[model samples]
Target: MNRSLSIIMPALNMEHLVGEAIATTTRALQRAGLSDYEIIVLVNTSRDGSHDRTDEVVLDLAKKDSHIRPIINHHFKPFGLTYWQGVDLAQKENVMFIPSDDETIEDSMVGIFKDIGQVDLVVPYTVNKKARSFKRRFVSRAFVILCNTLFGLRLRYYNGTCVVPTKLIRKVPMRSGSFAYMVQVLVLLIKSGARYVEVPMGIKPTSATASFKIKSVIEAIHALARLFWDIHIKGVRIKIPF
Candidate 1:
């Protein structure tokens, strides 16, 4: 049977929340009358033993429901690499990247799924910015502003969860191995003339225990510089049907 959508969930040490994330995603898909979808959980290496637990849980869920597919990466890689691996393995035309700990977007999943074929990409922006930390909120706003100014596109948000055509994604030359990869992919897609639609979605507050390091921000900045060079200076854009 052909699958309509493939949800790629990249998890590091999300043992406490991955189960609920999967449950919410699966339930939303099913509720939307979308039985032809697959949830691919790509578990990265973790020192907290969360990877092992995630494996167990995903295996059990996969046993009960064949739509749940889990891939365990033996070596630790950044979120972007894990996400790219899932994209390569996806069997659907439409692909979505959702974090393992995110649950606030469940209510909007059905509507997003319904809009799958209407556009080449579906970009969802968080409706609740107050849920984020001040630093996070500030950095996110600056990043989006910078991207829009540099790319000449007016996108409300660049880091939020988005759905894109698998073919378009596959054609783009993606190189970022950090968290900035999502932004890089979006920018490339837009430059490739992929039509997109933005929707408002709710976002949960950041977990108190989650790690938000300055090092990640530095890495994202570096990746953004490289992306700008490639897109603006080098004139890199994939040729895709709009």
Candidate 2:
């Protein structure tokens, strides 16, 4: 079968989450009635020996199902950003980005590929079923609000798994941005006038475990600065339906 969907996961020290992610994505795809999809596990080099574990998982899964491909995302200084590079490495017409740590969708959610229609991208909104702390919720909501109001691009969600077309994902090669690749992706798509649909995810884990540390703040600012420079300062305007 001419498989159209490609699942791209950029793993970084996700030993704990890798197994579940791979299992969930693959099983979900099969349950959705398309079992020929490819699952690419791109793990950045880490000291945690994730490389070995990844190899084992990918090889074993590949033996059972020929759709799983594993590769080490090697670099001297890891960018701490995989959402962009990971999908680009995929060899499929459609690319889905599911964070290794958070995000667990159902087989019905997997069917989004069939239901995607003419939309260029599909970004699912997360429902945090677990009662996370108040501080994390506040920050998450605040960030969404700031990005929407300040940028005028009301993207329903930002950080969870986002399924984008291969063409759109390829256009966004550079990982230089203020937040992570996703924020820049939002800005770029808004700049490119890409149409999108927001699917409400069933239950998402609170990545908002503790209060934001100083380091995380710095990374956020840097990611945002890069976006501003690329869009406004650099005079590259990618428009969206505000």
State the C-alpha lDDT per candidate.
0.81, 0.65
Candidate 1 C-alpha RMSD relative to the actual structure: 2.4
lDDT of 1 by residue, 1-242 (tens): 22389999987767778888888888788777788788999878764434557667666778888888989876777777788888899998888988788655778877777777888889998788888778778877887898888778899998777998888788878657777888888999888788889988787776654345788778888988888898989999888774
Model 1 steric clash pairs: none
Return the TM-score for candidate 2, rounded to 2 decimals.
Answer: 0.79
Q: Give the least accurate 10-residue stretch of model 1, judged by summed lDDT.
A: 46-55
C-alpha positional error of residue 109 in candidate 2 after TM-score superposition, expressed in Å: 2.7
TM-score of each: 0.91, 0.79
N/CA/C clash count, model 1: 0
Instruction: Looking at model 2, report the run of 10 residues with the lowest lDDT sum.
Output: 75-84
Q: What is the lDDT of residue 204 in candidate 1?
A: 74
- Measured by lDDT, the strongest candidate is 1
